[model samples]
Target: MTNPCASEIFKELSKGSRNLTDLTGLGGIDIFPGMLDLFEQSGKFDYKIKNGNIDPRLGGKTDIINGVLVITLSNDYLSKATSLSVSRTIIHETIHTYLHKQLSYYTRTDLNTFELLDKYFKTKYPLKQDYQHATMSHFLLGMAVSLYNWHKNFGPTGGTLGFDYYYKLSFAGLIKDGTSELLDEAEELIPPGSSWSDIDKIIQNEATGNYESKGEKCK
Candidate 1:
């Protein structure tokens, strides 16, 4: 059974996903169609969420067992994290669920271009330790955009937060052994004239700072 706090977090995530799907144009490009798919066909996804003991440093884990997708949010982390941070972790894990579903069930007749690209990357870099993160790095902009929209519509208000902040948050759990190189590759997507060093500082500060203390608690 989902804990009360986990249920609330999932509710917020659903609202954010629905908001994205209901919008049009989306700044001239569909930023998060995969998220739309995950929510729209949620009944078919066999996904579940629960709070549990996990690594202290981790916010959540997406696990596949017996054909089920289980997202476990660290109870300790959730207790301390703000609503926005918990929301980001949910989004990150759900993206992993989406990729697993897409790649595992893909067929040539029904495959989308994104799935094709996912397949190509998996094949090309089969031995990468962070294959999922590597594939997801190519699509961080979409995650960033979705996060910003979610925050704007359903999260805390004020303080001049923008896409750059959420964009850095989107990178929280994605920087790892096989996927760290993609961060350098993604520098092109950063704001014009902004160096990776600038982004690195933002990511570092977010990791170490107590900014979450200032935001609404997930409870």
Candidate 2:
């Protein structure tokens, strides 16, 4: 099978953002509003989405080049990943973009909150790397909500599984590189004495599973 063209990938990104917007209400949990704003006002925000060569291990990445915001996806990975997985990647990178932008322009109150959280995490997990990922950890529930809604509308599973499934999926890439400590923190948000081992297995399988097998494709 041929890899999806850049246009097709862009279309999927657009649709995914719209799905998140529909699911995330104002003042809701997560950074839904801020993340969605990047797409909703792309011109004003001055960001672009494109497909490019990147590490296969990374689904997507957001960065600034020549003062222009850019979100790049792994062309090689996209050819194999499912549409559902693609949606997850888009959501992940969009949040990164939102956080990146926050660094430059934010209200004092917002900046203070971020600093407080950053300082708290640093103190708690001195080895933690990537402040953005650390910050993203605090918003896992919001990410889970967005992913659950996206799957419900576009996933092959019809998103019929329990909320815990998506909640675990939200922890996909955050459980590594010293961010594991945050996973321990997330456990508090769930039931008492839940087994992350089982949830981790489900997330692992889903990450490598074929979208076509689930009645969806990355076309």
Candidate 3:
């Protein structure tokens, strides 16, 4: 099947700017049912209204009672936001969910080596600062997300990535603190003899080292 977001391609029409404070066309992002499916697949995001008022924060929310998603917004946002806002919102939420799912995977690995690491090393050598470790999965997943965002906002080369509402990350060089060679670095980590099948499996799968998922001990 075609990509779910395919129909909502921004190329079909121009998306004038829309701000979060101004809530018009905000509901437009929900036009693609799959987009909703994508979001739902991530966690528990429910449509809710209570006490006679719509929640106004786009800040992320989690359903503590059941472990799900619940982002709140106003009717004005649903009615007045533009396509750009909707697209960015979907992309942003999708990233959050993807990370959650992968962490779940790591939490399940039962390798003994992983158990040993968790028992003896992980806690002892815990993060000392910015000196942190990244799973291959996290790195590549980030690369993919960054690249897709680049495409969504910037489109193809000679295309635009602006939102007039909020900044959509564009080319890497635009960042104030880091180099833009991230994509290149992630791609280079591919195993030398790996095939497309190798690519199909989790990118973070390493020959050694166990991973933690959902705060559970895993390998």
Q: What TM-score would each prediction reach against the true structure?
A: 0.73, 0.68, 0.29
lDDT of 1 by residue, 126-203 (tens): 533266676666667666666666666677663237556777767766655424343443555666767666665654
Model 1 collision count: 0
lDDT of each: 0.62, 0.59, 0.28
lDDT of 3 by residue, 81-131 (tens): 333333333334333334333334443222332343343235533421111
Candidate 2, residue 211: Cα displacement in angstroms equals 9.4
Q: Per-prediction RMSD in angstroms?
A: 4.1, 5.1, 17.9
Off by over 4 Å in 2: 1-44, 105-109, 116-129, 176-184, 187-194, 210-217
Q: What is the lDDT of residue 219 in candidate 1?
A: 68
Report the Cα lDDT for residue 50, model 3.
13
Model 1 bad stretches (over 4 Å): 1-3, 15-17, 21-44, 106-110, 113-124, 127-129, 158-160, 178-188, 193-214
Task: Give, for candidate 1, the lowest lDDT window spanning 10 residues.
Answer: 105-114
TM-score for candidate 3, please give it: 0.29
Best-performing candidate as measured by TM-score: 1
- 100: Cα error in model 1, Å: 0.7
Q: Model 2: how far is 76 from its true place, Å?
A: 3.0
Candidate that beats the other on lDDT, 1 or 2, i.e. the better one: 1
Q: Per-residue alpha-carbon lDDT of model 2 for 92-210, expressed as tens digits?
A: 77666666566664422256435745674567555333556666666776677776776776566876766666777676666445333334555555545666665556554554555
Better of 2 and 3 by TM-score: 2
